[model samples]
Target: MKTPACRIFLFPAMVCFSIIFLLSCTGQKIVSLKTLLMGMTDRTGITQTPSPWYKLIQASSYDRKSDKVGGKGWFANDDYTQFSGVDSSKGRKEYILLDSDGPGAIVRWWMTFAGEGSYDGIIRVYIDNTETPVLQENALKLLSGQLLAGEPLSASVSPETDLKMRGHNLYFPIPFLKHCRVTIECDSIRITANSRKPSIYYNICYRQYEKGTKVVSFSKDELLQNAELIKSTNETLKSSGTISDNLNLYSSSEPISAKDSINVNIRSKNSAISKITLKLSAFDTEYALRSTVLKITFDGFQTVWIPVGDFFGTGYKKTTSSTWNSRVDDQLKMESYWMMPFKKSCSVWLINYGDQIVKADLNIESSKYKWRSNSMYFGASWHEYHQIMTAGAESEGGTGKHRDINFADIKGKGVYAGDAVAVFNTVEAWWGEGDEKIFVDGEPFPSSIGTGTEDYYGYAWSRPEIFSHPFIAQPSGSGNFHAGLTINMRYRSLDAIPFMSSISSNIELWHWLPAIINYSLTSYWYVIPPYEINIK
Candidate 1:
């Protein structure tokens, strides 16, 4: 007895209800910390169809390149130069870092000031040539390690205990439709005894896209509206381990003699190596852990060769503790969460090069993984320097030629993931003034350069306090400059360097004093297939 229009509406509404019911009967969408981490590494973000490229606008006041003979484009110069605010008829209150046409996003923002003023400056961001700022807040609170009370903001800070001290890092994505302008306002005060004005050091990294690309400008109102989703993500990141019931876990225990190699094989049609844990039981547990080599041949490629201890950033002796991607405890247990994907089969071998009878236990977990054509194989390599003497002029950015600590000499298509370094400082005034130089795609000079060793690892001013973050950590700090071994590691979760042909990554062996030091490094990367590589 219903009207014709009412009957038609009821039919469509019932159909919609049935669809919703069926979806409810099935499973709802699930998002987790792993999902967020995986999205950050999505290579699809690298566009090429219409040809869009990324650009970085680093406001290094004085040109560091002009100072060095063959220096990278944007080298260290902030220590020597001061950024004066934009002058107007009224006064100078803000310093413009970026004033560009966009369809882009500010990916990274790093700032550390030398002054009596606390880094409690204000930041103003304008989008689409708007007179009013889209985002404005206190710089310190905006990018603090501690959580804020208001709407959730996308940012992070390094460990407070790091010896290099406070190097403020902000990773909020500030996208713009047409144009973007950024400025910082700080009080002028005496910073150093020699300097009269407050000086600010900064590096702003951004990505520019081709015209007509769509971008959603940042909005505080939108963030406040969706605070629940942000809360969920924060809670998920704080939780540990897999929350799914479908996870597959496997374990194996075997006794290995000196020079004995034990191989653990996994055969699957379409699967991946998710997680691995290694534990050693021997009379000389420390020696066995330090000398045992982990070799992984996935789909017939010798992509991994590293000492187990060094792989976890525990060094030759266990003197510290950490819990993250690679974790080690006082009980001599090590764990790795690096995902290794394979199609036909994958094998992991533990080669004991030391003279010790050890009982090794290996636990592995696997899950279904969708392998794409452009997806690369996980790779790792290790290198060591018995005793490296820091000498001559050039190493300290002087006239003499500089020497480099080669982390990796890779060829073919790949992305430089991250690295771990362990140093035995003999006489330490400070063992790491060295800057990182990464030459991409066989360029004559390095395309990517950094300020200092600790800055590259996400801290500042030569801080050596122990800290552990999701992506970077300092497990050992030596407590003092000349104490002993200090180990630090960083894993690139949001910023992995990609190369088309080749990449040569090195750290200038620059230190305060000409002291001999023992150095060891493990570099991790991802490479395209052929299952073979040149050993350079």
Candidate 2:
């Protein structure tokens, strides 16, 4: 009995409704930085679903397990898998950087050549186990964020170019449905350096999806299609458009005496915190900032306990600068952009353990959130040691028993986001040789083990230079000898580590000199509520 006009309108309506229903049934949408930030806010407030759920993972060229502080007997065997030299006879073809089977995406890549003759190397990328490489090109051009004829891909390349050193970084997202294999042929390559020999230093940062995740394999055509989108997103980021829509809640805390703390409670249903910033002024700003502790509880459970400076990616009492998820300015202002979701209520406080009265300025912003059962509350923990000694085969205690500094130990389902570390070196002969071991879901051995401390922070050769990326930064470095402080931070976007039951993240305190070194770290993660966190 419907009119002909009704059919015209009803047909389109039915198609639109069906499309929306299908999308809703398909679960979370896979979004990149560009898609996530587009129209995320309105006149009323920010949107409910700006960020999609994803966990970050890193695959690097760490030396070997035997190099661990406590390996003994069979465990001390050498395992050199990161890079290889040019086979004089066959050349360095098929030099694999990453080989994994998954529904995942490679989010970032970095590489640097040691010695000489590496710029002319060829890079090959094979996706889904295809017999032929999906991409084959010059290593120098590809890593330097350029296409044919040196056209810059600013969205991808974030590098360090000094007179003595050159490092390449790439950030193009390469999604795969099945398998990913990357290799480099270094034989034909030639570096500008005067040396005759050359080696490779590289890092592969990616995100592993759930078993049933549907992903589109990356292709050259797809990259071209996303070219304009990527450029637009980069422009938005450069102009600081993504965060302009947030509602900032800022307050200066009442003067608190020594050993006293002040609490700020915010109650709202279906809301998520987007950012937090703080600055302090005191008689002894350095000691007071170090002594002050920040505690945050959400939905009736305590989640964060860290020093004010460490929580914001700085070593207390030191002048530092970095640009990432967290940053500390020269004027001592600290800022963080870790998104935190809460359904009911949240409480935060700062306790001054120092002697003088400490004045604090705080700002927190919240946005509309529709938290699901799988959504987890954000958590952070801090740990430090005044002096940790290096380990040798016969030195200190047993090798494996030499306690690795614990970044986090959690029970229940969660994702490890990232961390900031403050290294106070007493003797500065490369204190970052230690490896990272991340054990997930009750695994006896760490599932994600790193090559070196510097490598884990997206750099090479333990250089003392400042470099910042969207996800990682070395804000402060040991300048002259090794007597100063070095603070490093890494924030994960598409590469967060996920665990179903439990996870324990530790970094080997393998220093260079026998002298004691100070190590402090603040670990960040997200977990289902009603869980326990142990940090030592």
Predictions in order: lDDT: 0.62, 0.65
Model 2 per-residue lDDT tens digits across residues 339-405: 7778899988999988899988887777777777577888889988877775533343334333478
Given candidate 2, what's the lDDT at residue 322? 48
Best by lDDT: 2
Per-residue lDDT of model 1, residues 325-444, tens digit only: 566767777778777777778888999999988899998887776676666778888888778777534445443333678898888777777898888887746777666777777766
Model 1: CA > 4 A from native = 1-93, 98-101, 145-164, 177-179, 189-199, 208-213, 242-245, 319-324, 392-402, 443-445, 531-536
- Candidate 2: RMSD over Cα atoms? 9.4
Per-residue error (Å), model 2, residue 495: 1.0
